[model samples]
Target: MTHLDHITVGDQQVPVVTTTSLVIGTGSAGYNAAVRLAGFGAPDVVMAADKIRAGASRNAGSDKQTYYKLTLSGSEPDSVRSMAETLFSGGSMDGDNALAEAALSARCFYHLIEAGVPFPANHSGEFVGYKTDHDPRQRATSVGPFTSKSMVESLESKVRRLGIPVIGNCRLVDVLVDDGNVRGALFLRTDVGAARSAATEEEIVETNVGEEPSPEPTGTLVEQLAKEPSRFLLVRATNVVMATGGPAGMYSDSVFPHGQWGGAGAALRNGARGHNLTEWQFGLASIKPRWNVSGTYMQVVPRFVSTDAEGGDEREFLSDVIDDPNLLASLVFLKGYQWPFDIRKARDGSSLVDLLVYRETVMRGRRVFLDFRSNPAGALDADQLDEQARVYLERAGVADLAGTTPIQRLRHMNEPSYQFYLGRNPGVDLEQDMLEIAVCAQHNNGGIAVDGWWHSSVVDGLFPVGEAAGAHGVYRPGGAALNSGQVGSTRAAQYIAAHRAEAPEGDGFDAVATDVFGRAATLLADAVARFEAGAEDNTGTLITDVTELMSRNAGLVRSRASVLEALEQVTQWLESYPETVVVDDSSRRSVNRLFLIHDILTSQYVYLHAMKDYLDHGGNSRGSVLYTDPDGDLPWPDQDLGLPEEFRFVLDAGALDGVTQEVDWNGAGEPVFTWRDVRPIPSDDDFFENVWRNFRTDRGVPARQS
Candidate 1:
């Protein structure tokens, strides 16, 4: 069944190229993995969609992107152990893997800085740090709004310098899984950005002519697209790295770029199990010109405004909902730390802003917004703020502007925050117009399950890193995503380099390529027939329906009834996929969309089913994993499943003391879950020893350490 010639995919003939290590995705994690493998002298081919800069890592903007690292200075008494404890305290699964990530965090962060990422260091050459979502220690630093961009640009430069190959405009379509092992992967090279919807995209800000654009990453597929249209290309490798970033576009209300469908569904279909798929982090974000409004968006005390559809009836909505003025101001300030929505926080009024915003947008069916030009009308008197909120402003050096306009405080606190809106959003003048907002899907704390070696649990030689590697529990620190990319990439690379000698050469390129080619061709041929037949495709509407399903049923707050209902609808959609057509262009964009939509359908099934099971088994209401009703704050029907009655499951820094969830598999081999233990931190054991042992086999020290 092996063939050396090119495979026919629609009108395009795609050639098969084989390599040793194939890295899927060219974002922060993928590029870092590619570069590290290259540094270890391992050949790697990185695959990307549209371009390397197309991921949230490169495109997503935050006020000052928090890059969480362990405190390098001895000023804070933090260690790998403390960081590990914090990671595990976020809740869900094992902490052993998280412990390893914590250990390598400092090294990887410093590595980025050395590689030319200009992390903002003060005049004294000291990289000062600030607080982020989940950290007591001041371990976060930033270089304005472009933290991931900086990391990626530096890594991209290093990648170019080392001549690592990165293939762009490719979407991972068919994974070469044979004999229970992943040997290679296949991608359809085409522009399927319109797969989800034809909603008009906003204009990206233009850089000055003299400013150099980000460097292009170079990679070889065996990617075989010659621009004739859609071509099926196969890349055979000794190992495949999954770094496709978060599952965006999965929700109707998401901050993720509209076209950001990724590898979660691809991995799941191929029997690659994921971790914490039911657990996610959702919060407020901008819509039209998609962006996450975090950090200073709330810190500067923007006025929470709402209005009718015609822009006539203006109302300061938060004032009507909340009675206590100081509590209102304090809740806004809490958003600086508790950015992601948690049902537990909502009950205590901490996450009320998110709930109120949700209520306004979805329930009341009114537009909600954050206007920086003014404070909440008649509510935000400087003397009216809680002493804590007032003092926080003073500490941030914006006390003088506390009594002034919100934009005035924003300018004093974060000048970049004021300037970020100069031209990006249409009609959005922070100095004038109110910024429309919603509780959008921010990040999935869930993704492909992997071992300590960063290898996929389901397949040998498959390494899942970055957001693809769901090591995070229910919640994580703000900038930990960037840190996780570096740490996981480094681990995956080190493991590959150190163990490549002993890895079983799973399958030859010819056999794997031939098999994958047939699979891709058949799928493509059938999909093309659908497009040609005009098979009842409601792709755009279907995508919108599914996203709306996630937003309404399975967003930050969820209940068993809503989730189960959503599952019913999703299952119906999956069953009648004939109703969904692959939107196409001459480039076989339709064919490509077929694969993407299928992946999404399966991913939805996995999330709903897993969540249902967890709720059935008495999964506690906590963090971003909401189960019980938020309205009555009703307790989940504990089906006699023993869990700590008092476990708050707070997803914050130095959060809840202890918890764990043991993982299992269904008879079909899909991942299953159950509660494990409430581990108390032992004071007697040496902190360093616990984490040190995590790096070793307990049999011996790793060669890198030696």
Candidate 2:
């Protein structure tokens, strides 16, 4: 890392760091990208993050967090082309990216193994695997519940060993641009005095950092800011890799670990186009220390219970809807394998469980829980379970037809599942208390657009890998995201090392940097100036309002009116944010919150706009999202499900599968939305000599077509 001449912004001296490559996250993808970039001979690489210990990669996992890869052990007939075809089969996915992910899956997976990610392997030295949702082949592997955490730690060690600089406590404020190219990036440093704390008051000169800087205020806010210093840090790089996770902060009911507010807002604010932003995956997950409650947690046939606002009136909500106890148990068991809520399965399949959860939690304002202390409907006879459920339970050696409770079955079947909750900080003993759960946002199927090499489609010198990049589409195989992150980061690092190795020419960057910093300073100053000592701190309320709005209208269930209303409200929020949103304190925490709210609102507007546009385009219920169609038929009309008219919906059934919705925010009124036909899978020539010649020339990184 090289430090360039310092620039003055609003009476503060800001340090500018320049590098060949700058990675803006510290997740598995970001760490992998940095390690690979340095390994591939990139001159210099650096990583910047808001918090080093935060992010989903290190803090989030499931019953058995999986890593999807090509079939390596089984005799199943699997090939690169076959895996690519399966990935492309997911609606609205780009074919080239699918092919790239498939072709490089093994390389990335092995890279993880070499980095010390202990993926299970059989005695024959073949990596064993199991099938996951939407997977045709047995191509999923895991190292227990902490699979991603293991991957992050392993890759992070590689990054540290490579001597990469990881600047922490810096939140990305914006992606600075020059004309149409990515010049660099701007970050808000919460720890400002870490570099030069000994500067005397006599040496420092006062200058107008904001639009007009005046005498320092004597208010408590000024003293508070003095104690908690904040400054802006500029990173000038030739290549910027956005490996930040998905836009998980946009929804209140989300499984994304806290502090995983992604960089999509920064990319989108700077002209990066979003692809298929409307597609997201939602599933049942625990509340505190948020974690996915998939696999055996559901397979145990835990009793689904709900209570009123005060947790008084306890009732088995699922039993209220479904009279057949066996069918209910069967549905809950199926949720273990078919975890994500699927519109196709909403009729009579497992996803009906998700709907009931949603109805109880969101519609009726009740608290839902998975009660493991007892069985539902008195006693559950495993022999009476549906054939699929009975066989799975018996195969797992937990087919207790007697009086065993869910907790006992869980302990006998998967001890790791029981221990996970038992070992948490505010732990829950399944034998004693119920596990609070809700239908929560798990992942975004689409995000910032990227091409085959994981390079940004909208900006030069910009690459978006991992969840930040929209590699998946309407539906993806479970655990495919982990593979996509590794593969995409590797592709990005390779491309950068080969083509964009040199630092960006620092000719006109200072001017651009100054302008960008000036805008941020003005916003911060204005917010500070508007701070009131005893003013009602609506900051928390505002965040809750927006997040709840998303969860209610734009979550699994949606309607045209609710979406439009939410969109309009968000627009109003965005318009009045500067004037309306006030800070309780001017500390680093408050300042970070100030900027993050802006990012969240910007993301919400763009996402909600994409959803509204899709509805306007006549897009129906598809993927995890269920659009209300009053004219449509009820999913289970034959049964007295008591589902409201709002639940009446029709599935798209591949009608809109061939197209992708793209949105771009110009930092103006509303983001521009458009639809484009999905690119077909390529049929490349496999002639050995021809491919070898091309590989020899370009190192197999194909040139982008003009």
Candidate 3:
């Protein structure tokens, strides 16, 4: 392990105590990294984060477990390799390494179950799987819809059992590096509000060094003004692993709730610092040709049928008009026509599946109404249906379900579902609902470019896992994110362990710490200046700008114009960021203002990167967004974005202009921003036959036997 230099606490320098393998972020990736390191007998493994499970791992709607069934129509037989290729198929950057990582991730689910995760199981004790939109297989496994919750609980239990030290509510402001290798990190202990004031004063002292030290430390003033006490912590370690999630909170509106956005904010701020350090000492390599995340995959479960005054099921009527082969397939699977069916309708023929999907979309302020109100059964046994509905409503925290009719209940359930489930309802809705729904920003399929071994070309001793790494390609299959986290974490841990002996003793550890602290102090000073200038007081304006841009331009639909407009708005926000201010309250140590500032900055980074990628790969709506352009002006071919190339980086570097550049697609290096040769689907008779076969097989319901 690397030896620590002096620890800084409110201008007081303390000697290093010990060193450990430090895992940053406590979500799935971080947890897995710590667990695997401990399993390998790495001494003094410490996992730290601002908020552990509060990130994407906990905020995700479902656990989504399998991808074997998500093969593109008429593609080769599904295998781990084939799946990887498909995931990286698009011109969007990501490469083969993502495929290997995802393949390994699939096995992680089994590992979770072995660790006593208690995933939903059938009577036979086999894991019960269900179908979701985008995937052809009913391979998704969950324990209730709160798969993230269950997964977090199980991992948390495992971490505790290992007796690994976990420091929560602490932010890692900087990573200290020496001689092109990672040595340790600088952290701000955030448990005590009063301590934060002291730390702020210490920061001022550290910056003003070489000059006479202030006789009366400004930290004292911070204490006098603070409403609560704050504490700061610093940890020094040999190895550091970044398992931070994506940037969502910085954006005004996201598919995830408010809290989930903070992870993105932290990652953006801290990641920028880490990347910068790596760039200065060691040349950085990044996967280029980033994949375009056009929009979220949306499906709405049409459970409740809207009715007239007399009450009628409009859904059944509309069902006749719309050829809902997907819905029928679900019914067939649930009725024992397939191997993994668990969904069952109430006695009145109502299913929670539709309601769950409907409520989620409604809460997002999107339009979702059922058409089955005119059907004859819409009015059938209102009282009995209401009773069954009551069971679900109560569980969802809908106390007023008793007074509302089924149709009315559907409308009322929207708010509560959003408040509770993060915009998802389980069992009561069909997975098909996700197919046609509008969405807020959900996942970033595009991430840092990496190789098959999970190595970033930009820097050594730096690894990104889970959502932070971006290995899933353009569109990830359900449950694949969990798989990616496990795979990346495991690979990273193995690499670190194997290379531990060869790692050089870092030089200038103290100097690196000083630099890191210096940067953080600068950021804080700028933030303070903004607050004092009253330029940062436009919190409401910033919020409104972000919400409008994201909702209108980056939502479930997209076009070049809208995307460009959104980018323009993001640019303006970024320009205005340095001037933003904090109100300077009693809780200077907690630094909610700093948190928000970081969040906004990171959100802008993601938005700008995504927009640039979208423009580079032009085509009609390919994934979730519909492209109205008849000519398909996009430069990249219309092939399904595969995993390998989309996730791996061959070269990465930051431009002098501050824009980060990456090279991907098997060392094709930096993309020329030109169109590629297009490939056409074969017209052979077997093509259609195979398509029919796979479609029928995906439903797991027999179409016809040979």
Best by lDDT: 2
Q: On residues 580-601, what C-alpha lDDT tens digit does candidate 1 reach at each position?
A: 4554534344555666776777
Hey, what RMSD does candidate 1 come out at?
A: 5.9
* Quality of model 3 by C-alpha lDDT: 0.44
Query: What local lDDT score does residue 503 receive in model 1, on the 0 to 100 scale?
Result: 34
Those runs of model 1 whose alpha carbons end farther than 4 Å from true positions after fitting are: 1-13, 44-46, 191-230, 310-312, 400-403, 423-427, 501-520, 534-537, 578-582, 585-589, 630-706
Ranking by lDDT: 2, 1, 3
Model 2 residue runs over 4 Å out of place are: 193-230, 532-534
lDDT of 1: 0.69
RMSD of 2: 7.5
What C-alpha lDDT do the candidate models reach, one value each?
A: 0.69, 0.84, 0.44
Clashing pairs in 2: 10-209
Tell me the tens digit of each residue's lDDT in model 2 across 134-208: 999999999999899889889988777666777777889999877768888999876662233343321122211
TM-score-based ranking, best first?
2, 1, 3
